[model samples]
Target: MFAMLRYAPLLAIPAFSSVAWAPPMIRMVLLMAVAWLTVIAAPSLTPMPYWSDGGGLLLACSSELLIGMTFGLAIMLPQAGIGMAASVADMQAGLSAASLLDPGGQHEPETLLGSLLLLAAVVLFFTLNLHVQLFHLMAESLRVLPLGAVGLRLDPEAFMAMVGSSFLLGLMVVAPLMIGLFAVDLAVAYATRSMPQANVYFLALPLKIAAALLLLAATLAYVPALIERVFQDALARLPSVFGA
Candidate 1:
C-alpha cells in the first residue's frame, strides 16, 4: 500500500491501476489483491532480516517505496510522450482553447484533443494486454529486487536514454499533424493577404480546425502502431530500473 501510494499519480498516466473516482475501499482491495498475487507467485519468499529492526524496517519500506516509484515513472514516460503529443496537436489545430470533458470521470475539463487521445490510448493499452505484461514485470521485480535488499544496482545511461526517447515519441506522433497544420496556415495567410481589411481570424479558424480533423482522421490508422512501439520499447528498458 505504501509503495503504490508513493507514485499513484504516475501510474495514472497509463491508467495502469488508477480508478480515480472509485471508492477507497475498492482501491485498497485492488492493492491487496496484487500483493496477494505477488506472494502467491513466490510462496517461498520471506521477509528480510531488516524486518526485525526498526531502522532496517524503515530502510526496507523506503526501498519498496522507491521500487514502486521507479516502475511507475518508467511506465509514465512513454505514455506521457503520447500525452505531450496530444497537447501539441491541440495547439497546432487551434483547439487548445477548447476544453474536453474529463473522460476519466474526474469531471474536469481538459484540452480537447488530449482527452480524446488519452481515452483512445487507455482503451488500446488494455486491448493490447500490456497491462498483463506490466503485471508480470511487477512479479519479476520481487524476484530480482526484493524489499529492503541492499546494494541496489543501476545504469544511469539507460535511464537517460529512456528520457530522451520519451521526447522523441512525442515528436514522432505529432509530426504529421504539425506539418499539415503548418501548410494550412501558410495557405490561409496567402489567401487572406490581399484582403487585409477582412476578418481573417474568423475565416482561418474554421479552415485550420477542418484541416486538423481531416489530417487526424487520415493518419489515425497508425496510432495503435505508434503506441505499441513506444510501450514495448519502454517495457524492454524497465528491468534496468531495478537492476544493472
Candidate 2:
C-alpha cells in the first residue's frame, strides 16, 4: 500500500491513456505487476509502522494523495499542451466541426486533428522511453517527499507560470503551421472579394484543410522535437511542484 502511494503519480497516466490501448483486465494485471516490482525494488520505502493509528494514517493518506496528484499533474502538462496545439490547428483548418469518437472513456468526442496529434505524441512518448524516466523521477521524488510528512507548501505564482510556459511550448510547436493556414485565409479572403456569389466559408474550408495537411506533413519532422522540448520543460519544473 505504501508503495502504491509512492507510485500513485503514474496512476493517472495509465488511467488516461493505457485504458484506451489495453483492456481493463490487462491493465489491472499490469498494474499489479508494477506494484509488486516497485515494492520489491524499494523494500525500505515504507512509512512509519505507527501508521496503524487511524488519524495519523488518514493524514498520511491525504498528504500522499495531494502530493501524488500534484506530481501527476506536472507530468501530464505536456499532454495538455499537445491537445491545445492540436485544437488550434483544427480550428484554424476549419476542422473543429468534425470530431472523432474516442473508443474509450465513455465515447467522448475529440477533434479529428487533435486526436491524431495526441496519438502521435503518445507514440513518441514511449519511443523516447519517457516511461522509464518517469519511474526514475518518481523514485527520486521519494527523497524530498518522504512518507508520513503531512505538510505541503505550494507557490501559486510558480504554478501559474508553469501553466503559461506549457501553453507557450504548445504554440511553438504549431506556430509555423498555423501561420501558413492564416496566410491561406488571407489569400482566400482577398480572392473571394471578386466573386460575391461564392460561399466564402464553405469554399475556404477545403483550401485551409489542404494547406493544413501539407503543413502538417512538413511539421511532422518537428514533432519529436516538440515532445522533447515540452516534456523537458515540464520535467525540469517537477521539483518546484513540491514548492520550495
Using Cα atoms with residue i matched to residue i, what is each candidate's TM-score against the true structure?
0.84, 0.85
Per-candidate Cα lDDT values, in order, are 0.70, 0.73
lDDT tens digits by residue: candidate 1, 16-106: 4434446667666666666665656653746667678989877766766666666666666776888888888788787976655334656
Mark the 10 consecutive residues where model 1 has the least summed lDDT. Answer: 5-14
- Best lDDT among the predictions, by candidate number: 2
Error of 2 at 224 (Å): 0.8
* Runs in model 2 lying further than 4 Å from the true structure: 12-20, 43-50, 100-107
What are the clash counts of all predictions, listed in order?
Answer: 0, 0
Mind giving the per-residue lDDT tens digits that candidate 2 earns over 105-172?
45565776778877877787778887678778766766666656666677777777778888889788
Report residue 6 deviation for candidate 2 (angstroms).
3.2
